[model samples]
Target: LKVTIAQIDIPCSFGPAYEGERVRGKDLFVQAGGGKTQCTEYLELADMKEIDDGKVTVIGPDIPDMKRGEVFPLGIFVQVGGREFQKDFEPILERQTHHLVNYIQGVMHAGQRDIAWVRISDAAVDKGFTLKDLGVVLHAKLHQDFSAILDKIQVTIYTKKEDVDKLTAKARAAYKYRDERVDKMTDDDVETFYSCTLCQSFAPNHVCTVSPERTGLCGAYNWMDCKAAYQINPTGPNQPIEKGECLDPKLGQWKGVNEFVSKASRGAVTHYNFYSLVQDPMTTCGCCEAIAAMLPGCNGVMTVHREYTGETPCGMKFTTLAGVMGGGASSPGFVGHSKYNITQRKFLVGDGGLLRMVWMPKSLKEEIRERLLKRGAEMGCPDLIDRIADETVGVTEEEIMPFLKEKKHPALDMEPIVG
Candidate 1:
């Protein structure tokens, strides 16, 4: 970390430890994004001649000019040019905006891509901190951390409504293009999958082997995300795991995955089946956003999010299910996964894929309803969405069974899940 910040004068204390501190509404000096306005952060590769080196542009009012507790639309756009930079690394650098900005004292950062939310504390603003300091921190930190690949860094902060709206459209387009590219890719297209041990700091035995269809349990890092992380830091938590052999394509059991997990988990978890929760399922760290549980009565699986407080048809709440399934234990009848992963073609493919999903929290169902409907249609079960039960339908297996039978759910007709 060759961070040289001699030119910029920082007014307040700043570090990683302060990230957990909260800035409640009463204490906040301003809020950006958080559904109040269009907020986006974008990083792009450009020709060296195209940008003014080391320049920071603010297109609207400075921080001091705004009233306290005000809301504003913001856009952070960074363009870098260097011989070593690649287009694939753009999103990788872009993702760092969350952490780098959060390092500023009295500032909080959350979310990524187009839905970034940030807050400034009154304490820092009173100490002379301004929006321009945000750009300075980004410029200095990016140059310091990514100097090997970034020869020149230029940032433009847009606070004006028209400017933010225009930049957000471009940012959203880039986001969609990257997502589609990763979504269309398959495991066969790549020779290696990535292993993420980020959670190993807490759960020592946890290892996440991310593929094209599967993402990190936190629902943040996808295959492309891990790929870029590996390129950025070869010795970091993310590394490539070669796909040695196809042990079971339907179950997504691989020789290399087994070998890596055995070594990473210190032999605690030696066997893993990707698509079936009833077999030797993948172990999870407690950080997973959701858990998939087996519902024997309906011969299907029910997914419950960590935020969901209600019980599921599986007879367990999210907390009970996570406690049973997490801590890097190879437990059949339970698995951990990202919410976005449910729509993938490989999701529980060994146990009938999307058709195996019978129950999920209503909020989660609504969050993923569009994707679920599209996947249902693709699986030749366009009516599957309505057939799947939610909290409103019933929470217990017996309570939901009648509804399943009434809807003629395919899982009711499928083979017994608990053999």
Candidate 2:
């Protein structure tokens, strides 16, 4: 029942759990991106004839030249080709870079797209790790992880500032194009949704149905990612689910999703509301990137990202809330989601949507600030971002009410979030 990625010849230990390990200053040998300088990673689908199989190009000095604990810009660009390859799968495969790189012992990876961060430990350097070795890990892992649709993969790592800067612009453009494609598609536009059981390895009873508006709680798989995953491995963790009938458009409950949840979760859950926070909300696996909880007294909900350790206005810290929200069980008044999902149209639609968000950690708010601004403008609340409360404002419902009233926050007047 266990699936393992093909082994690669490397100098360090590697495993799934190492993906969560942090590499801090004292132990760090070198880093790529992490705000010290520019860094971007990109993947693209190319014609089979366009790829030179097994090629790894390092444009600048290799790992040995990197000063201890120094940060530098890096650009990793991957090109793949196969008879069955589709452009939609580019981003899907691109996301694997994070986990694949992390699987190497002495290495840590974070972020995605044009803002990836990586660190190599001193022990790894002492063991003869180099830029080319990093590419070898990626090349081997990509082939092993996605052999179905990838016939060839070629990686180019850029370390010089000029080279990275030049490639980063191109990578960002590709990232923008992918984003626009997803933006135009909505949950109602697709007759078929995808199911993600990747986390089932950790949460046995968990099954996440990924729609255009609702991403998996782990935040790594979106609709397109799942779609491509299904295409590559129909029998794999990601599978296609037919939307049998729309039971409630506003609440985002469908007969097909309900049935699928019942069967996939081994009948632990039978009903789910995709858009609501307090009514049969979808159950989440433990890896969700954020938690959304209802603040009943304020007629709103407050979300806390998994990375934020601060207490939220709802009287719970993120870790405390996660204990109740995850493990494949649906809990009313609690939901888990991706930070990107916060800007979607169906985000908490059944509970007055984004306007119901009254508090978030300041850091979390800043992380999604641009998206929130645009969403606020769309909702006719041009100043909504300013109105929303963060930790700097208050961390208790009682303390938050005065600020909400002062800013005339929309959630203050919305219908009650609780029955």
Candidate 3:
């Protein structure tokens, strides 16, 4: 069966502010000014009756029987004639466009004079084309007068199970592709410059620079793609990542990164210094994706992810670690300087050793775990992953605590598992 799909562009205001509208008994029809408004609606003209009226019915806002949030599929099937209808709409049926005139032109080429079958759906309501646009086009074609166009159109009210299954499968395949792409991303693939325009929603002045190996503190946007996007839209939402000078190896300091961050963050961060958490300044921002808090005893640093709100030994937020590690924070041992680079020296021991504990979700932890373990083994230390209690890995908690004690360091406390 030939099926045409079109989506409506409905200006839906259904978030927090719409709660008042919902409570005030403002129906959709009422919101649309009693259907008098010329709203853009998408129409799908099809030759076959693939949609079932029982499955795809439009629920009028004024209908008392309909539930408040009831969503009904709005589609209509019309039979014009047989031979002329088949020749006219068939050619344009496969093409996707908002303009009906384009479809008519294609029909004219096929030597068809009139519309044979037309399907109507409310899916494209809020899009650029409105019901009035359709009426105007039909009236101009002399197919039907504007006054009687509404009567000629029949609404198919129910969505067929097969149609739902087809849509679901299409969506599933797209999601699978995305998942595969993410899984296939390599370290080198991820290590590139990126811009975090999304953060502007929370931090008006803040823009995160991402690289391939590193991601935004919000854990979105890998390096290479972000860099490419910035290049494509130079002054638009994303910008370039200008490299700064190398940081002092011994002191774990970078002059260029510090200067850039100080200015970018609007003096929220100044005089970038690695280590020395107490005397040196910490990262302060109007908005931060993560937060790091010192544990009460200072035995070890505890990093918290923002979404996690339970009792942490350090009471820090994930935004803290993400920001600190992203660089310019005076917290000792925190890596990720200048929002662009992810250096091993920044977080590991030698200079910046104050940052001891890093708490992240399983996904992120797994992504970096193997690399971190290799680094630990090279440094003649037990891998932090081995110390952490995880069923997937063989290392036990017992084996990990001894290493921490032997190294004169306190064991890290992990947050409880969240669903």
Residue 327: error of model 3 in Å?
A: 16
User: Tens digits of per-residue lDDT for model 1 on 1-419?
Assistant: 23355544578777666655667888899988865677778889989899776688999977887988788999999998878888888877886786677777788876565667789999889899887777777788778777778888889999999999899899877865665667888878888999988666446788989899887766667898889889888987789999789999988899998999899989888879888888888787665668898888788889997668777777788778777776778778888887778888888888888898888888888877888899999998998889999999899888888988999888988888877
Please list the C-alpha lDDT of all candidates, in the order they appear: 0.81, 0.82, 0.33
Instruction: Indicate the residue-level lDDT of 199 in model 1.
Output: 62
| Per-model TM-score versus the true fold | 0.73, 0.78, 0.41
Model 2 spans > 4 angstroms off: 1-7, 13-40, 46-52, 57-75, 102-131, 145-148, 158-173, 218-220, 285-289, 305-311, 315-331, 361-374, 377-380
Looking at model 3, residue 363 earns an lDDT score of 41
lDDT digits (tens) for residues 254-284 of candidate 2? 9998899889989988989999988989887
Q: What would you estimate as the lDDT of candidate 3? A: 0.33
Better of 1 and 3 by TM-score: 1
The runs of at least 3 residues in candidate 3 whose Cα sits more than 4 Å from the true structure, single-residue gaps closed, are 1-8, 13-198, 211-213, 250-253, 266-292, 296-298, 316-355, 358-379, 389-419
Put down candidate 3 lDDT per residue, 174-239, tens digits, no spaces: 323322333334333322233454433334445454433334433223444355444433554445
Runs in model 1 lying further than 4 Å from the true structure: 1-9, 15-39, 47-50, 58-74, 119-127, 158-168, 198-206, 217-220, 245-255, 258-273, 276-340, 359-374, 389-404, 416-419
**How far is 17's C-alpha from truth in model 2 (Å)?**
9.2
